[model samples]
Target: MKRKKILFFIYTMGKGGAARTLLNVMNNLDRNKFEPMLVTLNHDGEYEQYVNEDVQFIKLEAKRLRSGILPLAKIIRKEKVDIVFSTIPNYNMVAILAKMLSFTRAKVVVREADHVGGSLLGNLKCLVYGRFYNRTDQVISLSEGVKQNLVEKYKLKPNAIEVVYNPLDIENIKQQIEIGELSKEVAPIFNQNEKVIVTAGRLVKQKDHDTLIKAFAETNEQVKSQLVILGEGPLEEELKSLAQKLNVEDRVHFIGFQDNPYIFFHEADLFVLTSIHEGFSHVIAEALASGTPVVSTNCKSGPSEVLANGEYGDLCPVGDPKSISEAMTETLTLPPEALQMRVSKGEERAQFFNANKIVSRYGQVILNTFKK
Candidate 1:
């Protein structure tokens, strides 16, 4: 019997949530039922090793977004794919056009991982694309907050948009834990239990690393915990200068682009995320899975939802450094058992985003959609 084909469409195979989520779907999809393939706009980025070797990977050179969809649709037909899943914004716009052109009865799944609120330009763009988004067979958001945002801002039918949390490779991470401390095969950050405060995400305005720098600087220097920012991007210089201006230049370290980020979580005294807003913060789950304590800004949507309204980790007002610092200081003073409880809480919540479970949801969505 011929097998069904599934294609994951992505902007890039970069080390971001969208790419990682695409890999999660590819890795965990039942092989007996579906054959997985990856279609990426660009091939450059992290986490390439995580993609299953059985799956075919094809990269279409970047071009004018509209022009590229026609070619991408050609690949879909050539691959005989039954479904095309796109996770980036422009890719969604392209996915609709491509599938329409293919005329091959392929289902198009558009997943939005970016925070919809807190960005005027983003919300406006979503409005313009509101009517066209209906062309997608299904629209997936990472959090309920995003789901609501889409419904309210774009007047999308709530039923049409599904909230599928980002999948974390929990069992894989646990297996790597057994391998050794060097999970990523990358060198460790070389700091011993030096009260590390760590955050990992692209250095973008939404991540608000500059706010984290200010907050860390305000924390009592007597604690003297090191501030480490993982991941790299456009805001590196501005964030570094903020660290300097806050007089925490020597204290804050910008460790750009660590492929294996969990090691820092394991080694750190506290894991922190200062994102101004997020659709969902998958790194929080990773930190918990690594048995690390966490703290984050009470950013719209993800952090509070992931932290169970502060049950899993301490929450500070977004962009408020002193409040964040105070929360971190208080977290540092908690009893060791309390920290353990927090870690356990985070680990407990991590189950909701386990790789197999999330992948299963995708499988169900795909099969159900096709059945329709």
Candidate 2:
């Protein structure tokens, strides 16, 4: 059998969840059956170190997507790539356009990384995706929620989409936790007997950190606890201001991004996600793998799916501070045996997203596309 030359294209090798998921997929692909290559619009990103040495890495040297389309097309034609797999909306569109312009017979598979019902701009982009996505061979959704949104909102054919949960390297995360060192600034936050609540993600509107702060403040005042947010973004100051206004600033610790967040997850009494939306939260799975029980807003997707409707963790209404606060307090106050049972269930659920299984699902998708 001829080894299929699969080209995984992305805008960059950034540290975003989608980028990390793709890197894991590429690294775990069966090299014996498929020849994997990576193409980045720009060569620079924090995740550059994670790329496997065996995979052929190409940089278009173009700073933007518009400038890289021609270069992308040229590479597709020159390499005669068998499959062009791209993630996120912009790169997916670029991959389809490049393949069309280059007139390559390669299968173009695009992955949707977020829920589509967020803003006006997002809805408009959904329309554009609906129009152009038909040209691609397959559409991979990070969750069934995202897949249904594409089909119902965009009127896409259901058969064209596949739900492949993001891959998590549980072993790799565990290893990192073993070798991971805690930051000096965040070290003291966990030292006390107070319940420690942690959340990890970029500080942005999408993450809804404001809601998290408000909810943390609403938690039982007598219940001593600390809220540690492990990420940095444009809204850092805004979130800090919200924490101050709520009078929980002293208890809210904004420990900026850490390379190894698994350590914090391992130590946390509870992990929470107050995001307004998500396709599939890698952090939720990571937290679960670290044996931390979670509390997440029942966003458009992901949390409910990963938690299996509250079997593994608790879910609250999206953007509702009261609901989130109640869930957090309930989770925190649970009997020690009850919390441990939930944590054990979460650990079992996390294995469903093991890198090997998810990568094999991706491999099967690529192979099926090639067969067609």
Candidate 3:
């Protein structure tokens, strides 16, 4: 029996959530059923080492998304790809155009990893999104909230969208935590007796680290805790300045990016995410898998769904430092047993997004697309 050929196209295999999620799906895909091909404009990335040997890796000659359209279309036709899977809006557009121009029998499946709030994009860009998104054989959303946004904000057909949460390697996270130790540089930060609050993401405006820093200041005044931020981005200096301005610089530690964040998650007392929006927050689920309590801005899409209306963890309004501060303080000061109960239940919730299960769902969606 011939396995279905799938071309997993993305901008780059960088250390981003979209890339990590795609890597999980690719690495975990059943070899007996699917032939996975990872295609990217650039071959060098943080995740290049993790690609499975059975999977074919292709790097395009073109470096930019626009320049790669014709080359991608040529590869799709030449490789006779059964299905083209791409994520992120720009990559999705490129994939759809490639499939359409390739004139092959390949089906196109685009995954949207961010909420498409109506006001976020310009009218022209929104029109383009609607056109290309509707042209695909199927659309995969990282969360139900993202699906709703695509349908309502972008006018995508509700039936065309399938919600598949980002796949998590729960067992791998456990192993990393079990075997990993705190590095000498960060070891001193964790040596203290104070409760540690951790938030990991690129230091970008989307993460709203400013709000998180302000909230941490408030929480610090009420409770003895340290803020440890993992991941590097352009906003590092600005965030650090804010921390200093708030007089929390001594307690706020920007540890930059980590090869294995799961270990930090396991060691931290609490995890917090203050993203302005997300299709699905991978860090929140990772925190849960590591048995760390979460305090997230009730951002559009992921946090509320994962937290189950604040049942498993605390949820606060987006951009509200006071609410986030209060939530952080409350969670930190919870009784030991109550905190353990939430952590235990959160671990169970994380299981729902295990790699095997979520990747199977994606495989089924690809099969259904082929049948169509």
Candidate 4:
């Protein structure tokens, strides 16, 4: 039997969630059963290093997305792809276009990665999503929370959307180490014998790096540790100013966009996420895989779900610096032996989101879509 040709599409490989998820899926999918291909709306950004040897990538020159319809149609027709999977927002529009123009019987699968802002236009998107999304045969969401949003806001048929938690490369996390002590090349911008707290994602309003700055500033003098944030974005200067204003600038280091965040995950003393909202926080899984103790905000959707309602990591109320400070201070005091025990728990829990399991779920969804 011939292998199914599946094309994974994304807007751009910008350093955040969707791009990383697609990159990991492409890297780990079974080559014998599926011929994976990729389409990037813009050729720019990282994660290209992880694209599989067998998978092909096309850099569509869509200066304005209006230009993409003709070109995207050409690629779908050329590849004769069986399925086109789109991630996040605008790219879904692009995938729908390709599906409309393709000569091949290509199905479209769109994944929703965020919950809040989406609901605003979600009703609007769902109208299109309902009219056309069902045309793809299936839609995948990163969390049950997001799936509920899709169903509630869009009145989507329950059967139309499947919740597949985003995958983390646990083997890579295990092999590489959570707070990587092995390689300085990808190390989180600072050398610290002190207790280390790490967070990864863009520095922005939603990520709430400012809350982390205030929390770290309040860490009692007796506790020895540093806070590190990974990823670069529009809020860089503002976050730096907030750190300086909070007087924790020395202790709060923003290491702009890292290609090798896994090393930081491996070696860190504790992992923390301060996001205001998320489809799912990928770093939390990375931290769990790294075996580092994790502290996070009880953000609306992803963190609470990923933590299994707080069994996997410590949860503090969102935007509360005092609570976050106390949590970090407590985690900082844990003995290495006890810390290892916590890390062991994380390793077991992280298996739920392991890369292969999630990718297989993705493949299965695409196949099931065609069955109907």
Highest TM-score model number: 3
TM-score of 1: 0.93
Candidate 1 residues 58-99, lDDT tens each?
Answer: 878764566679889899888888888887677788888898
Q: Candidate 1: which stretches are off by over 4 Å? A: 117-121, 178-193
In order, the Cα lDDT scores of the candidates are: 0.80, 0.89, 0.90, 0.79
Instruction: Kindly give the number of clashing pairs for every candidate.
Output: 0, 0, 1, 14
C-alpha RMSD of candidate 1: 2.4
Selected candidate, larger lDDT, 2 vs 4: 2
Candidate 1, residue 258: Cα displacement in angstroms equals: 1.3
The candidates, ranked best first by lDDT, are: 3, 2, 1, 4
Q: Which ten residues in a row have the lowest lDDT in candidate 1?
A: 182-191
The positional error of residue 216 in candidate 1, measured at the CA in angstroms, is 0.6
Q: lDDT tens string, model 3, 160-206?
A: 89999999999889998999999998988888989899999999998
Off by over 4 Å in 2: 118-121
Candidate 2 achieves a global lDDT of: 0.89
- Candidate 1: give the clashing pairs: none
Pitting candidate 1 against candidate 4, the one with the higher TM-score is: 1
Model 3: residues >4 Å from true position, as ranges? 120-123
**What's the lDDT for residue 88 in model 2?**
86
Ranking according to TM-score, highest score first: 3, 2, 1, 4
